[model samples]
Target: MPSTDFQESSSSPSSFNLSILSRRRDQVHSMDSPPLESNGQQSDLEAFQRTVAERFQDLAAAPSEELLSIPWIRKLLDTFLCVHEEFRLIVFNHKSSLAKPPMDKYITDFFERSVKALDVCNAIRDGIEQIRHWQKQLEIVLCALDNQRSIGEGQFRRAKKALIDLTIAMLDERDSNTTVSHRNRSFGRQSNSRAEPRSMANFRSLSWSVSRTWSAARQLQAISSNLAPPRGNEISATNGLNVGVFTMSYVLLFVMWALVAAIPCQDRGLPTHLFTRQFAWAAPIGSLYERIMEESKRRDRRNTCGLMREIYEIEKCVRLMNELTDCVEFPLTEERERQVKQRVQEIGKIYEAIKEGLDPLERLVREVFRRIVRSRTEGLDSIARANLQD
Candidate 1:
């Protein structure tokens, strides 16, 4: 039951914290008063660190059976969006200082990293569509076998054909490097010919889908490249704002990496070396990463389309059902009939899980995509205004 809404509640503690931060920011901007105390700034930065550490700790503490499941992934996105909102507010409070030398560079770099993540979001949406396609095939199998008084060769043949189609579709997804753009899919609203000529509008137009050769693994590498922690001197110079920027950068990288890990994407790869032990959030993030990587390396999980628990279940049930059908005789013994029903029952359960979870998960991803777009657009605008006033 993780909350999926992107907006923070007005009565929430974070909202109260934001109001306090806003008042502090206003005081610092007053021409009649001296600058705000450094202690106030330090405390704000500390709160941000603690919030991130606590959220990821909760995620990492999930039981092994629940880890990487659909609900778990939804919770992970919820964490990212919450932390991201807090980070966005922190940047707003410090906007006057953002146009300065090193802080400017740090903020600019974080935006660049965020831009890369937009592509990841689009790729993930396509990946979700890919799963939906597989779901349709599962539904076909269910229709062929479910609710029958007694199983027959015709029913078995129909179910087997759907299973075979599902197998081929999944294998093609894992092996094919072709652009998913050909599917004409996107999470964004339909572009209007008369819309404003804004940068974000143009960005949406061009990036509604990934290019033919676009690789999720390579995009992740681009985001992680040169993403080192801010040094002590840099932190001192930026009044610890650099640390926030770096923290958001790493969060962006890790979240996108986890999405690619859980969903089918072009050229999927997990780069384990991107994480570091320097931050409090690192341990939980790293723990989750290791668990997923181990899951990927499992004998049965190898060559699979994704590491999602539902996807794994689907594969297992399909295989068992397929095997049972292949060994069927025209006159099914009572025990053999029971076994077929058991296999069908297993598939039915998985089908129900996918049916219930897939739409909600896709909606969460769409929210993630929209939140990233809105944040980036607002941030870049804020930076431009800051530069102008300076």
Candidate 2:
């Protein structure tokens, strides 16, 4: 092609592609060159391009910090935190892909925030476990306390009944049969008993009362050992809830944790699964809360029956306890003073047993409490030191 030919074609640059046929064809295209875009489809396309340019200009001019503060824009940051740590890392790939520095400020910010979020999540998890441990312990303790209380009440009843029965027997001696009338009646004389009294005047009656008391106690223990608890999840669960620890955990984990770990997860992988699985575990925190309420009703039913059995056992024990309180020096009527001395010895033996058993339980509880306290105290101390350093 001639130099003139190239110049003619270049004159209509928009139509230069069609110059394959003729140079004169290019001149004709120049004469018919489209006017600067105004109305119709051409203008609409031009306007769209201008709008795109303006958007880019505005984006460049905007302050990054202020832009990030936008509710719509801040959503991106929220997504970063709520996501699983692994998911976020994989999706964004850190700053390793950077040209030279390989350390992205944005990526580092995400790392720090994610770690903080995970820490918060862990704190929330531990808080829940602590609450659970305490609550379960509370159940066992309350049950034991209730058992102890039953024992106390039963003792009181036995003491009163014994007083009444003894008084009745002592007063109603005249209504006895021939054997009692012969054994203790003073041969129609008003002398002190040469033989044993009908009630507890001698060795045999005293021994018999002691035997009866022991027998009654054994029977009660047998009954209690066989007694079954209420067979429902209600009382057991509600008792668990009354622990008060669950509520505190709810506030910390659900309300506070949601705020801290609301990062989005766009990737799918094992790490992402771990994040989601961890979050899924949180579902129990919310869902089982309803179960806590249901537990209330169930507990009432089961406990009512259970409580009765426990109370009855305590009653029987208290009765036996009173009978055994003072050893029989043959009989209460014949020698109350001597019997009381023997009872003191028995009580001493029991007190020693109680102390030994209580020691281990007390020590275990103390150890658990100490560990929790130490961990918390150390954490608070570290936080204070960090603030001071800052």
Query: Which residue pairs collide in model 1, if any?
Result: none
User: What local lDDT does model 2 show for residue 152?
Assistant: 39
Per-model TM against the reference:
0.82, 0.19
lDDT of 1 at 281: 62
lDDT of 1 by residue, 1-390 (tens): 012221223332333223223343444456454444376676777788768877887897789788878899999999999999998888777787777887888888888888889899888887777788788888888898788888788877888899988876765665443332222211111122232235433533464377657877778889998999876545556766877788888888989988888887776774456677666666667677777777777888766777889888988988888788788888789999888888888888888888898888888888888888888888878888988998
Q: Report the C-alpha displacement of residue 363, candidate 2, in angstroms.
A: 4.5
Per-residue lDDT tens digits for candidate 2, residues 1-390, read 111211221222132222111222234346774332223322332232232223222332334223211221233223222222222222222112211121122223222332323333333233223223223322332232222312233443444454344333322221211222222210111223243245433422432212211221122122222222212232122221111121212222222222212111111001011111111122222222222223223433221111111112222333454565444332234255344334334433433333333334233323333433443344334434544555
Please report how far candidate 1 places residue 22 from its true position, in Å. Answer: 22
Residue-pair clashes per candidate: 0, 15
User: What's the lDDT for all of these models?
Assistant: 0.74, 0.27
